[model samples]
Structure formats: C-alpha cells, structure tokens
Target: MVQTVQSADGTTIAYEQAGSGAPLVIVGGALNNRQSAAALVPPLAGDFTVITYDRRGRGDSTDTPPYAVDREIEDLRALADAAGGPVHLYGHSSGAILCLEAAAAGVSVRKIAVYEPPYFTHHVRDEPWEVFANKVKTLADTGHGDQAVEAFMRHAGVRFDERVKQEPWWPAVVALAPTLHYDLTLEADGVVPEERFGSITAPVLALYGDASPDWAVASAAAVATSVKDGHQGVIPGHGHDVPPEALVPFLIGFFHE
Candidate 1:
C-alpha cells in the first residue's frame, strides 16, 4: 500500500511497502525515485517488509524550497516513524550518504547497509563544483533539461546506448535534471564527513563493488573503520552500479542478525 508521511518541514514523503518481515527502507541515489528500487524489491521482499520511497522532489514526494541536508535527515526520521519505529536502512550511491548521516545523528534506526557511497578520499570531484552545477543549471533552466540530464550522465561516466536513449524512462530522467544539481550540491567534493560517520554507534555494513573506482573503496573502508560495529565487503564482478542480488545475501544476514 502507498503511504505518506509529513516530514518535520511539512514536505510529504511518499512510500510503498511489500512482503513481510522487519521493516527495511531502501533509498536510491541521484536522479532516482521509488521506481529505481524495482529491481531490488522482488528478491528482498521475501525477507524484509521493504519500504521504498520517492525521496523529496523525485517522484510523488513533495519538495520544499531551499534544500538542506538536515531536512532530508528529518524526512528519513519521519519515514522510520511511519514504519512503526526503528528500521533498517539500505541506501545506494548518494542516498547512502544520507543513510549514514541519519545513523550518525543518532536517529532511530536498527542497522544500515550502504552501497558504494560516492565518498572520495583524495580529489574525486574533478571540476570545481560551482562550474559543474552552473552548467547543469543553465541547461535545465533553458528548457533543455534532457540535455542537462545527458550532460550530468556524461560527467558521471555513464555511456548510454542508443537503445537506452530511446526508452520511455529516459524522459523521466530528463524531467529530474534539476535534482541532479541538488544531489551534486549535497555531494560536496565527495569527501566523507568523518565526524558524522565516526559518531555513529549503530552497526553499519559498508558495501563496495570490486570493479568500483579506487575512491569508492577508500570511502567504504573509511566508513567501516569509523563506525563502532561497522563491516565492509566487496561485491565481485560489479562496478559503481552493483546489482541488487549481489547485495541481498549480505543485507539479509546483517539485518537478521
């Protein structure tokens, strides 16, 4: 069933739930909404009451102007409250950063599993962020949001096949271009916020793909080291976009324990 929760700031966060077990909330990264969790839901549903949501501004969720990291954190807290209390969290890419931040803030969460959060060790953010953001802002503001999406994808090393460009879902991506800038702003040079990660006392499972970039490995490693009871693992034969199956077993094991 679809459910809605009012975040502390009054933004309405929409979510869906399925299967039956301990509550597990899945948060997707940049340019993603609830639909992005489709691939993971089936396999995970057997073991968890999976709750997938449209993080504000992405899908059915409403957004408040002047975004702030703490606001997103509050949205998560509201979701957890709706789930009947503390729940496990699973976040991919930039969404993983949000999950870690929530846990660090001592929010009511049981455990967390984050996959390849775009945390850079040295200097992964190649260009000065404002330049990149300005380019995207210009394209999105100029009524060429699709091109803006394309630009952001290219910047992220995404090589889209012609067939992918032809897909119906492509337009949805274009429509969400502005949120890409919001995400990049949240990323902020991809550096790990050491103070936050280190402050987290809840158990964390930091997942990195074998084929992921060096910076991803460093970031996950740093997170695992910081959390009091955190663990790290590598998903073999995967890149930055590790498939859901590679994550299922580890997640089931961690949350069940």
Candidate 2:
C-alpha cells in the first residue's frame, strides 16, 4: 500500500509498504526511489514489512527546497514513526549517509545496513564527481536534460550508451537533473563526523564490495571501527552496486534476528 507522511518540515514524503512482519525501511541511492530496489523487496517482504519510499523530489514524493540534510533525516523519522517506531533501516550510497545521520539524531532505528556509502577520505578523492556535477549543472542550465543524464551515468561509473538504453530508470534519472545537484552538494559537504558515530545505539551492518573504490572500502572500515556494535562484510565480486540476492539475505538475517 502507498501512503504519505508529512515531514517535520512539511514536505509530503511518499512511501509504499508490503509484507507483514517487523518493519524495515529501505532508502535508495541518488536518482532512485521505491522502484530502484525492486529486486530485493519481494523476498524482503516475505520476512518483514518492507517500507520503500521516494526520497524528496523523486518518485511520488514532494520537494520543497532550501535542501538540507537534516530535512531529509526528518523525512526518515516520519516514515519510522508511521511504521510504529524504531524500524530496521537500510540505505545505499548517499542514502547510507542519511541513515547514519538519522540514527545519530536519536531516531528510533532498531538496526541499520549500509551498502557502500561513498565516504571519501584522503585515500580517495572524487575528482570525477565534481567535474560531472559541473557538467550536469551546465547541461541543466542550458536545458539539456538528456546530456545531463549522460553525464550522471559517467559520474556514477555506469556506462551511458548501451546500458542506459537497456536500463528502465535511465530516463527517470534524466528527468531528475534539477535535484541531482542537491545530492552532489550533500556529498561534498554533509558528511557525518566520525566521533558522532560512536553514539549511535543501533546495531549496524556495514557492507562493502571487494572491488569497490578504495575510498568506499576505507569508509566502511572507518564506520565499523567507530560504531560500538558494528560488523563489516565484504562481498567478493560486487562493487558499489549490490546484487539483490546478496543484499536480501544479509538484511533478513540482521533485521529479522
């Protein structure tokens, strides 16, 4: 079933709920909404009441900006409240960052599973991200949404030409060019402090792919080291993008326990 929750900031956050056990909230990466994690949801719904949401400005969610990371956190809080409080949470990429911040802010998160959050340290610098953001911004300014989506694919390490054509969500990514800048801004400046991580009371499962960027691995390691009850897993063949089969089992084990 689909519903709307009003965030503290008054934005209407749209969410879909399926299944019937412990509630689990799934947060998707940039340019993704409830549909991005479709492959994992059915299996997950069998074990838990999976709550999938369109983060602000995407899918069916409403967007009212002066975008701030805290506002995004509030959206998650509202969803958790609707789920009857303190639900298990999972986030991929930028969504992981949001999960971390929400837990830190004392949200009633039961457990968290983070998949390859791009928390760059000195070990990895995001040169391509800045360039890509600027190029996309230029394209959007010039009203070239198509070209902007192409640039986003390159920045995300996804090949634009053949694969984008084959993927169903490629056009949706292009349509959301205006909000992509908000994601970049958050990535560049809104990292959670390492010291604050220790205060998160929720059990955390940090997953990284062995083939992921050095920085993402480093970030996962750092998060595991800092959180008191955190565990780390390295998926052998995957990178930042996790296969649904791999992710569902990990999440079910952690959350349903």
Compose the digit string of candidate 2's lDDT tens values, residues 159-214. 55765656786677777777677667656643447788889979999999888877
Specify the poorest-scoring 10-residue window by lDDT in model 2.
120-129
Count the clashes in each prediction.
Answer: 0, 1
Number of residue pairs clashing in candidate 2, backbone atoms closer than 3 angstroms, sequence gap of 3 or more or interchain: 1
- Predicted structure with the largest TM-score when compared to the true one: 1
Candidate 2 lDDT (Cα, 0 to 1): 0.81
What lDDT score is found at residue 98 in candidate 2? 80
Which one wins on lDDT? 1
